[model samples]
Target: NLSVVVIDEAHHYVGSLGASFQGLLWRLERLARHYHARPVIIAASGTIANPREHLQTLTNQAFVVVDDSGASQSERTILFWDCTRDPKTPPSTQAAYLTRHLIRMRRSVVVFSNTRAQAEYVAMAGSDRSHRILPYRSGYSAEMRRRVEHELRSGSIRGVSATSALELGVDIGSLDTVVLNGYPGSISSLWQRLGRAGRTDLDALGIVMVGGDPISRSLLANAAELLERTPEHAIAASDDTDILTRHLLLAAAELPLEETSIEDGPGATAALSDLVNRDLLIKDGTTYRSTKQRPHLGTPFMEREASYEIHFQGTRDHRAVERISIRQALREAHKGAVFLHFGTPFRVQRVDSERREIVCIPETEGHHTQPALFRSLSQGRILEHLEPHPTLGIERIEALVVEQVTGYKEFDQQGRQVAKRKVTSPIISSPAEAVVLTCVDPIYLGIDPEDLFAGLHALEHALAKVLPLLTNGGTSDLASLTLRNGDAPSIVIYYLTKSHPSTMITKVIHNLHEALSLAEHLIAACSCASGCPFCVLDARCDDEVIDKGAALALSRLLGKISVGTALDSSGDEEG
Candidate 1:
């Protein structure tokens, strides 16, 4: 019988994982009810803004929050290193240097990178004969990860470069320093990574190496603000239709789901009806049963996607080296792309889509590959709208997004572009939801069509950097594009994951005034003469079309009009 349940790192119970966990909790609660046993659940987290609400949403139980237990923290020396000041050295190289230096001082360190590929790259760059650094991420096999954890605990290894996979409550012995390769995208995450060090009441050092991204650069300019900002609230879409459908199917397969149970959830009733219509579930009397056998075996609780097996050319019998998701395969395991495994590089020989396999050969050449993508949006259907002002309109719409990888560029070990190659690849398309900001009149703002597009485009990039502040998500969680509809230009901000609900976009539309105010402040606070990555320029976009002055003017106009003020008739805007 389950008496007590403990959930550590409860902050991570968001997104698709959170949705699955919610369904599991419902099942457990029903089981406990049948057994006449009341189980107590304890959810613990480091530092999240909405811990109480987040836990309540996940488990559907009221919680009395315990904010503090009279615990004391060790002194941690936090340093924000502006790597952009010295553009000569890349941030990863600088991080490697810091790792080596810490190891030399007999201080165990953990360098946190944002992505798996970056973790591998940093590990490869930092490792030396004297001190060996290994990469630790989710992509590695279970045995490999355990080996690295054991080595770190026993002091067998000096350092490790890892992604967020290591940021959780994993016991990896003690450490003296933690180097953040870039802004981990949120304040809560920043503190969580810093907490990795100074675990045993010992003074520790934490370094934040500012990256070239706009958000990282903005944080560099306003380090005090970053340090003092409130932690973002954690949000989870438990009522998402797709997620609810999968979980309801699993629930029915576990035990015939009762009609009352189906109606208790937010969208479970409709999902169950759809499943019944599709012949995946059958209604017998008052309960529903799944037709498929062991539905959970085929259903993944995480984001739905196919996995691709990677096979090395010269291996004995050609055993699979690693397995990556299809999304990763398209970006990293495409034909001619350089795939990294355990700090070693391999050039992808072929991507067999039919078999869902990637064939790669060991790459002797020391270079990295970056994919170039072509993305477009179509078939927009408006879901909700808010006309806060006469000149501005905010609408949430569902649309179809198609993305294709057209080519890739190769960069040498020194971080210089070496060559560019074009390749044909399959196109991936999905349905997406977005929040669009429509600018009614560019003439009123005293800008031509060309300048208006540039201004809106710059505003889109700026918004992408700052929206995370309000949404409690990463910069990569949303993407933006500027398009013209008839006479008005609209900025479209959409989620990166297709299964994500419209809650995030809805939040943006509701608090657009705040978002616009933050965007304007971000652009104006920068000291650059024109535009730099620190402000209006996004490194991911075409830099030639970005106009800093026009962006500032448009942002000022929008900010003014959002607060019920009309545009000045004289058209003498001071930006």
Candidate 2:
């Protein structure tokens, strides 16, 4: 009998999906009680906050947490090297150059790239300079990966470029350096990758080479914030209706759940009745049980990480191809686009959305593809409204978002636009649970109506790039919409997560004063004069060019209101 269960890398299990291992742990707890055997759980994560609460929620048990480390530590050196956007050389090329230099200095190194293709490119470039470096990613066979790890530890290989697949706690002996090709989306992930070096308490170096993206550039400028942040709390949607229904059905199948015995949230009377209507369960007065036709819930009790399979020739050989998330496939796998698998390039022939698959063939083209997207947000009904500040209005809303990949733009090695091709694909729509914030009377703050609109647009773009820093969600995981309210002169801002009905990120932003403070701090601290990429400029904006000065003016105006504004002599506003 299993008496203990240990989960490593616990942060990976936290996701927006309603389903999670919590249900399975609940079942295990029930079974253990029936058998009179207690199970002890130990979950370890390098970047998890609220460990005690997270553990209790996952296992339905009360336990003490021992978080302090007993191991000794040494001082580590972290360096941030900011590069110009649209640099003459790509970030990958720079990463390769640095890795080669470190290897020549006889320092063992691991370079972390965001994508497999990037990992491959970095590895290849480093190898051109020095032959002792190699690529290490997920696509390689287990034996091959083991061999590479052995070589890295044995000093046969001086450096290895990798993706997040190698970011976990894998033993590779003592190392001297770690290189980050780009910001890894979250402070937790950044620290975890850096922790891979200096394991032995030996002095080590961690280099962060910022990329051209807004997130990287923002982080590059605010390097101290990255190092000073506490890890984000890991959240699981245990009370999600869809997830609860599935688990409740499984609980009934497990051992005939007594209605009064289970917890109130997921196992309430109304939930059971709803399941009865679906024919998945039967209620016999006070007790409920599973149907005889199917007594087991085959869908595993874990967060569902769904992916679309890429078919080389309609064969299911996992080794020959890679799987990408459905969201990514929709955005990047449209016809005429280039797909990169483990750093190898392929041209997409077709995308079968119905089958959740993409068909592609080898490509000899020396260009990368970028999707040109058309997106819109339908008006939503307000479920909850709040006036956090006299000038700020907040609302919880339900809306629909449609994204269409209208075409793609190709770029060559020189960062020059090569070709633009149109794609005739159906629009992808999804329900959006959002929080809307409306700012009042921008014209009274000494800004013209046209500039007000441009300013709002620029603020929305900047918030979309900056919100990721304050929350666990990445920039891709969040979407926003900004426009002047048709019925009123106020500007409305909507922030939506691609997952979950409600998110802590939105809850945090509901504090208008805090949100405005962060926005003002970001803009005021940036050195860019007219909104370059490091400030408010958005390369992905399809509407119009943003007015940087107007954006700064609007931000300052909001800040004034948040800080208690008063009417000035001209009847404008002063704080």
Q: Compared with the true structure, what per-residue lDDT tens digits does model 2 show for residues 1-575?
A: 76998877766655333134676677778877778887788777776667777666666677687766554456899999776754887677778788888988889999998776577667755764345677788746677678878999888878999999888768664787999998775667788898888878678899999876655666766678668866666655555454566677887887888877777763355677788998878888878888854545365554334677886643345457567765567677788887655445578898887877788887676556778887766656656555546556555566677778899888664345789989887677766766566666555677776676678777776676555445534344466766556523333334443454545434435444556666767777776655644457554455664676777777777766643322223322211
Instruction: Show model 1 residue runs off by greater than 4 Å.
Output: 68-72, 211-213, 252-269, 272-298, 314-320, 378-399, 433-440, 445-451, 458-479, 483-489, 495-575
TM-score of 2: 0.73
Worst 10 residues of 1 by lDDT: 566-575
Show pairs that collide, candidate 2: 117-343
Candidate RMSDs in order: 6.6, 7.6
Please give, for residues 1-575, the per-residue lDDT of candidate 1 as tens digits. 77998988998876546767788888778778778989999888877898999899888899989987444467889999988777877888789878988898899999999877778878877888899888989877888889998999899887999999998768654787899998876788899898888877778899999877655666777787678877867766565566678878887887788887654664677788889999999999888999997988887766656788998876444554798887778778889988777777789998889999888998888677888987777746667656667667776677777778899999777667889999898877777778778888788677876788778888888888777667644455568888767678789898745554555676566667788889899899877656665567665564456777888888888887653322223323211
TM-score for predicted model 1 compared with the true structure = 0.80
Candidate 1's clash total is 0
- My TM-score estimates for the predictions, one after another, are 0.80, 0.73
Scored by CA lDDT, what does every candidate get? 0.78, 0.68
| Candidate with maximal lDDT | 1
